[model samples]
Target: MSSQWSQGEIYESYVGRWSRLVAAEFVAWLDQPAGLRWLDVGCGTGALTTAVLTQAEPSAVVGVDPSEGFVGFARGAVADERARFEVLPAAELSTDAVGGAVDVVVAGLVLNFIPDRPDALRRMREIGRTVGVYVWDYAEGMQLMRYFWEAAADVVPDDRERDEGRTFPFCNPAGLEGLFAEAGFSDIETRAIVVPTVFESFDAYWTPFLGGQGPGPAYLRSLHPNTQTAIRHLVESRLPANPDGSIELTARAWAARGTS
Candidate 1:
């Protein structure tokens, strides 16, 4: 089944909060100076774009995504005139309305979702002097999603196909570095950004799945009620929860950067 992105609030309830934490760290790692123009490719809900505005003091931030609802949500969420959101795909971004090129371009947690990823990188290179991206290490580093998918795969054999770890091999360091090299980028580098993914209760961890935004949650909602409960039980049984009903774990995102 395909994923729908019209429900911005629901997505924020699930992944956007954690994405913001990673965005801050991603920008900090960039360590660029203030007043540089920034392009945020696949800027879902403006999490990374807002992080750059809040953390980097960029002269302007242009965010591009294919979903109108996401662009609208980001436009309303961040009112700074220095930031702008567009309902366009990463591969189609051009010079901004001011006819200006960006100093840096980055994608946060969105590269794996773009269909024509190599084309997207080439297009990003056209808009900036430096390009970079970061994605959740869904295979083993993002403990929250790893638990959900592992539990789902155990209960539903077919659900393994929908696991992002299986679908998006490009999320890893070697895979990303290969992409940059193929795209003709120089001075390439890759690193990891770690963020905490803690849930206060089983409900806190499971209720977000009902939002049905991403692939895992979409697959969860597609199941029969009893099957869904079984998967939920399986996830709960595997989590490392404490006496206070909190589940604390780390999420690692692999980030890559290179010069155009």
Candidate 2:
């Protein structure tokens, strides 16, 4: 079976560190009871899984991801006895493998990467004890990529064509609510969580993409060296100039719950 788009190293590199902050905020919003069993789908380096284990004080936490590298890193990083990592895709989760119903299923910034998201939601509902799930992605109009693309547009008009290459499946709020409803979840709620992604300099912002960890990296790789240099220069000039030199990007997500 093909892995989800998030399995690629490019997407992972850009979002990996930031994922910890995202998970922490999500856990804080949940305020769920302690000792509940939790499942982390597309767990990536298990950032959200670790956050759930620590904040929710869950009885146990199991994190699954399609990337072996991510699973390996997660296993090495999160050593709590209650937490475990597995190399599995979100679509493959089942009651038998999880050993019955889970109290909550969490997928942080992962839904958009899955092509068959509705099916994945169905699987999550089937495995969840109490249908509590958190899903978030880049909001369409407010995406951080807007800054990057703006810079690219100045240097290369064709960049816009490439930018529209793939549709971000979860960029719309109504689409998210509808997906959950179709999956049989009730009491759905959506909220915006903003995190300030501060970069010390242009290098600080651009270096992560060099690692080929996300869409930014992919876009960067597609450009010629001269074009890439021009894009960076334009981005730096367009950005708010500051001595401290930082950029703030807002992340929005939807949280929904139900009883199975």
Candidate 3:
């Protein structure tokens, strides 16, 4: 049980906000036909599931997550009978649960977190005729969190190596496309999706880190309160702010899709 799968609301506050922005672009690039059956692996709050429903006409959608809290929230929030949520692991998906395979399978902000991505991707391919994935380009393309880590390095030089950006190098296109290839997918296509993450104030931007939703926020929780404050100060000192006290930043995610 990692904190990453703990609370859906806390995660929505941290990265879900930006994931929604990316989901639209991610589904747009999916470019699949309407009336397709979709399986949203690691759906997490139904952001991607909602994106698919909103952007395209899907006959049915099944969302799976190991987190019960997330599944519960998704079931309650997404009102369509066409969309359903289940507490299931990516590695354990089967034809029975997915209704004998879907037309397309998509995972959002999830690939980098899978313990065994090759196995998970293979399962995804098994559950759908098309398999796809997208993750925040934490290594380079996701600038907002990267900037936070950049400031963090100044405050706690000793902990710089553990930053999310440094640790998740597979967030890039090459890594993702390669995973799809390894999973026996063909016609693979990968693209970068960039979106803006704006905050009304610095506090608005930084408070999510206190939610303990992901590794970065979990790392923040590990530090002493004084150290956390120092990191916050460093981050604020480094960020460029607008006159109205708002901060506008961009986050990019690498997406890849292919047929099996």
lDDT of each: 0.87, 0.70, 0.86
Can you tell me which runs of candidate 3 are displaced by over 4 Å?
Answer: none
Better of 1 and 2 by lDDT: 1
Weakest ten-residue segment in model 3 by summed lDDT: 1-10
Alpha-carbon TM-score of each model against the true structure: 0.96, 0.87, 0.96
Q: Provide the lowest-lDDT 10-residue window in model 1.
A: 90-99
Per-residue lDDT of candidate 2, residues 6-59 (tens digit): 443444446665667767888888778998899888887778888897789899
**RMSD, one per candidate, in order:** 1.7, 2.9, 1.3
Candidate 3, residue 37: lDDT: 94
- Model 2, stretches more than 4 Å misplaced? 1-13, 131-143, 161-166, 248-250, 253-260
Query: After superposition on all CA atoms, how large is the RMSD of candidate 3?
Result: 1.3
Clashes of each: 0, 6, 0
- Candidate 1 lDDT, 1-260, residue by residue in tens: 01466667988988889999999989998989999999888788889998999999999998888888888899889889999887777656676632478899999888888777777788788779999899999898999899999999999886678888999888898999998887778899999999998889989988999988888888888999999999999999999999999999899999999998
lDDT of 1: 0.87
Assess candidate 3 and give its lDDT: 0.86
* TM-score-better candidate, 1 vs 2: 1
Between 1 and 3, whose TM-score is larger? 3
Clashing pairs in 1: none
